[model samples]
Target: MDLSGKVAIITGSGRGLGLAYGKELARNGAAVVINDIDRASADGAVAEIVAAGGRAVAVVTPVGTSEAAGELVATAVETFGRLDVLVTNAGILRDKVVWKMTDEDFDAVIDVHLRGTFTCVREAVLRFREQGGGGRIICIGSPAGQRGNFGQTNYSAAKAGIVGMVRTWAMELQRAGITVNAVCPVAATAMTETIPFLAPHIESMKRGEPLPAIIRRDVGMGTPEDAAGVIAFLASDAAADITGQALSIGGDRLALWSHPQLTATDFHDGGWSAEDIAACWGQTFAGSIESVGEEFPEEVMPK
Candidate 1:
């Protein structure tokens, strides 16, 4: 997919996954706008892209703030004359269980992941609509959000919110030809390294230990490049009809996420009393939920 003449903005594009996306998109002919909170990182990425014969510019701005988000899109338009795609890849992690998670930790994560995504998309979607066409919005989600994790209550909740944003925006912006989607990329970045409790797993990774088998193949561990390909594809015209969807991009595997399947259906229409809700919760949380006579195989076990 040639993105020639298209103007694309990728948040957090200093290094890691964001940088990978910016590099690939620029190579594919898009006039890439690299956004990062750190000016040096953003400029460095732009330099690399330019050195490679690709067109790119760097803009350092906080994605979580409304003013900064607007400036990010404005920078693209001012530099490239129009906006075509937005990749919301900026985020932070505060790993803590719900009870132990402080309000600041929760807010920081939510502001960066959820609010930042909304800010960027909201600005880009308007430009797209004004240009008399739809545009693509690809958010960076996570498996932690889809399947609850031990100490990622904040991260998981923020990411889960991104999925909800995609679904809602897809419905609200489809009329204007806008397409909203998200990709849960599993790249080992600074965030992963900073999770203190993951040191053992990091050491294991260094030792080339493999993850459990039952998880989807494509959902296996991956590098930034693995996720970049999907981000680039979704931003291209080839994925025009695809919206309101979340995908898992890991390794050589790419799978459509069935995030909702993890949650069982509820039959009641009206609100249930507290006792009724307690009873339902008790039953739901009671025991194993695997298919009848089908035990969870070792292959599908968690890491």
Candidate 2:
């Protein structure tokens, strides 16, 4: 799918998954506006894209604020003449169990991931409407948010909120022909190097060796590039009808995630009292109870 005349803004794209997204989208013919807090990295990314025969520009800035959001969109429009896609890939991680997580930890994650996504999408949507057509909004999400994680209270909350907004905005923007979706990506980057399951393999990655087949196929962990294809496709015309969906992508693994839905429902003649519900809870709801947290197969243990 070619994005020959499209322009895209990918936030936090200096490196890692965001960088992968920018490069992939550009490779597909989209002129990319790269956003990142680090000026050096942002400029380097833009240069790399240009060297590879792709059109790109850098607007180095920390996301999560309305000003930054406006600047990002403005750069896309002023430089490329129009904005066709936005990927809210900026985020931070503060891993701590609930008891140990501080207010600072929580707020920091929320500001970057949750608020950053909100402001960026808001700006992109406004531009799309002004352009008199539709656009693509791809918000980054996490598996931790879909199923709770032990030490990711803040990260999970922010990601969960992002997906929630995607669902809501998809409905609200349907009339305007805009598509909103979430991508839950898993890859080995600086952000995930400390993860216990992937930690042992960092050395291999540093050596430029491919991720072990077992890790990619069984554990679903891979390089950032493995997950970039989906981001690029979502930004292309091919995926215009796909919206309000949460998709998981990684090395050797791609799956469509089911949104929260009722597995079972029962009706009462009137309203069931607390005691009346307690009496029937075991039979009515106990069978459909779902487990939480990410599940790694025993075979996935790092050797």
Find the candidate with the highest TM-score and give its number.
Answer: 2
Residues 1-303 of candidate 2 have per-residue lDDT tens digits of: 799999999999999999999999999999999999999999999999999999999998889899999999999999999999999999888899899999999999999999999999999999999997899999999998899888999998999999999999999999898999999999989888868878777668888888878788777778899999999889888898999999999889998899999986777888889888788889998899999998887776656
Any residue pairs clashing in model 1, and if so which? 213-299, 214-299, 214-300, 218-253
Question: Weakest 10 consecutive residues, lDDT, candidate 2?
Answer: 294-303
Q: TM per model?
A: 0.83, 0.97
lDDT per residue as tens, model 1, 1-303: 889999999998899999999999988899999988888998899999999999898888878888988898898999999999999999877887779999999899899998989888888887888898778888889877787667887888888899999999999998888889989886556776654433444566567875433222523555567678888798888999999999987666777886465544345568778777677875674453533211233543446
Judged by whole-model lDDT over C-alpha atoms, candidate 2 comes out at 0.92
Cα-based lDDT at residue 139, candidate 2 = 96
Maximum-lDDT candidate: 2
Sequence-dependent TM-score of model 1 = 0.83
